[model samples]
Target: RVDGEILKGWPTPTGKLEFWSRTLHDWGWPELAIPKYIKSHIHPENLESDQIPLITTFRVPVQIHTRSANSKWLDEIAHTNPLWIHPIDADRVGISKTGDLVRVETELGYFVLKSWITEGIRPGVAACSHHMGRWKPEGHKGQRLGISTVALNQEGSEWSLTPRKGGEPFASSDPDTMRIWWTDLGVHQNLTHAVHPDPISGQHCWHQAVRICPAKEGDRAGDVSVDTGKSQAAYEKWLAMTRSADRYSPDGTRRPYWMLRPVRPERDAYHLPLKTESAEV
Candidate 1:
């Protein structure tokens, strides 16, 4: 079967390969109706002198953190998430060698982790796999296979997590617990990440503009600090970026019906609710 013609020109409303979106134009995003690159929050012009773009968009194998049928071998292979930094950035940040602890400061706060200085990554960007930072609070029961027990503390809106210890062999019912050897399980970097939803696509933007530096005097690897208040503030900041659909639906519909909908509602249900006196409120 042909791709376009067989479907009578793609499923889109335009019935053609559209570089421009009529729905977007009528639904409050005229400038973004055409395909274009909007500067991200981490764009060079948007960043400070010491800031660099941190790419947190990718994930590692599920076995690195999540249970894979409780298979012990998968957990042994891939478990640590180190910050991938180019040698140039490494030297610039005073990371003399690999495994040196580094602090990656974000809009809300920072997380510390061992650095893996390598040429595998871009010089100007830092990357950490989101897969391996699984954690459990201090005095809380957590899986021993792929997590670090951490001390969790909170002061008003600010919160901090410090790994009390990394993975170590522990006596338990399972014999494999004694065979466990790895220590670096990774840090919880997700907490420090601020929310920034794309105005048009509505997908969460995962790229972060951050400051990378050598770990501070008291900083330990797998340490994370954040301000919940700042995280909430960031959510609102990106929320304001969106153009409200109710104000600009050309046909008073919630969204373009032509697009794929996993759970499609009745045609009439797509229309905006009747504007009552309270609707304006």
Candidate 2:
């Protein structure tokens, strides 16, 4: 509309570009109905003395998402998501070497990864690629260039991942699979991450505040340790932050009809049937 090509107006209910979202107010989030500043979950001020900001949003220039893991040339250049730590933070954490293994502990669990100490990253902040770290179960199919074969074991409320094998030279159809030299294809760090659903927007908060420490005994590179019980607790903690549709629906509908969906469902499907309590109760 700024270009005034057609001048039809905007898509909102008001038929104008919305500065204040009436839909959000009617749907139970009045504070966020208008454009305003909100504190980020990973704001550095919210961090404890021991914690540092973990920037997971950055990916290598060559690597795309999981699909690019199969690209041999890309994997050769950016195979691992090394923990990019600044020299000051590295020295504080007792990391004197660039390739030293470091344990990054999140709210749910911890994963060990190699630290790349450099001045590129800011002090008191560390970053790892959002890409990389693709894994497959021992018997599952995985990419040849940048995937690790691992065993996912679960016992009760505990889950553990053990690396059975990493990318290695093996004869295969492409013959490049046999030329695979890198054994460390990065770590599956996401498995240890806790869900961080936004209370109003209903989006997941990706950045995390984590504590970095020197790798302890028995901690191997790419090793991930998680307790399903803790993860469940974290899930519940984030779930409580959301305003459920059942409690906040504006017109007994699951979602706003005007919202765009790739495959739209029937209008009747949007309504939720009224529940009646049984007399036996």
Candidate 3:
């Protein structure tokens, strides 16, 4: 059993099976084995129905799959989780640029995040790369270079490095010691995820459609503004449908499932709703 339903054998779900068959048939390919009892659930009516919401997975540059993104060294290479949206969609909602903060909103909820507007995504749909933003304490340590190097000058009997205010030279070695500061710490962008569900799988997609906008004047940099009334309501709706325990088989052991586990219960409130805003680019 999976998701409280029994799967009798090794056949693809009715919906996916039909899609494959139709796709093959339309392309002039051979028809594959499709069980007779399993009705073709893909109908023009269903395709046109409102049941299916936009579905997409996120991708980022620095991380490979889920494993590397969690490593300290790799995280420093790319710090933020950027949302990818098509230019047309971005234009429709007012998203402007790669660095601009944008909000994406759906019926279930909304989130505010930095936008990476491009033509890669399909119009009316957006994507966010998972991994990237990470906040582990040790990870913070890797962000800044601890010690710096400096240049020193030696003139006749006098040798000096740049002096600190109200103090002697920062350091004076046999060869003048100079100091310079450097950093390797990168930004974490994963804080923008919110709880949203896919209608078909009854599983949370963890991404939300939203609008993007500039931080208001005098607003702290990186702070997002969310409508509490809307966010809270959306969260409650998701909570109602989420399963308390992992799905299991009829015999009580865990079922063979292929999906990622939910990270935690935290949502961002700063994103704009898709219908209300346009891409700023």
Assess every candidate by TM-score. 0.90, 0.89, 0.41
Q: What is every candidate's alpha-carbon RMSD to the true fold?
A: 3.0, 2.5, 18.8
Itemize residue pairs with steric clashes in candidate 1: none
Cα lDDT tens digits, model 1, 1-281, are 37555556777786788899887777888888898987878888999989999989666665533545246676687777889999999998799999999999999999999899999998899999876777888788857677788888999999999888788888889888899888888887888999888877788899999999999999988899999999999999999887776887788887777778789898998888878775553
Worst 10 residues of 2 by lDDT: 1-10
- State how far residue 18 of model 1 sits from its true place (Å): 1.3
lDDT of each: 0.84, 0.84, 0.41
- On a 0 to 100 scale, what is the lDDT of residue 89 in model 1? 95
Clashing pairs in 2: 170-178
- Per-residue alpha-carbon lDDT of model 3 for 97-161, expressed as tens digits? 67676644444323345667887776655666555323233212332221112223445433222
Please give the range of 10 consecutive residues that has the lowest summed lDDT in model 3.
160-169
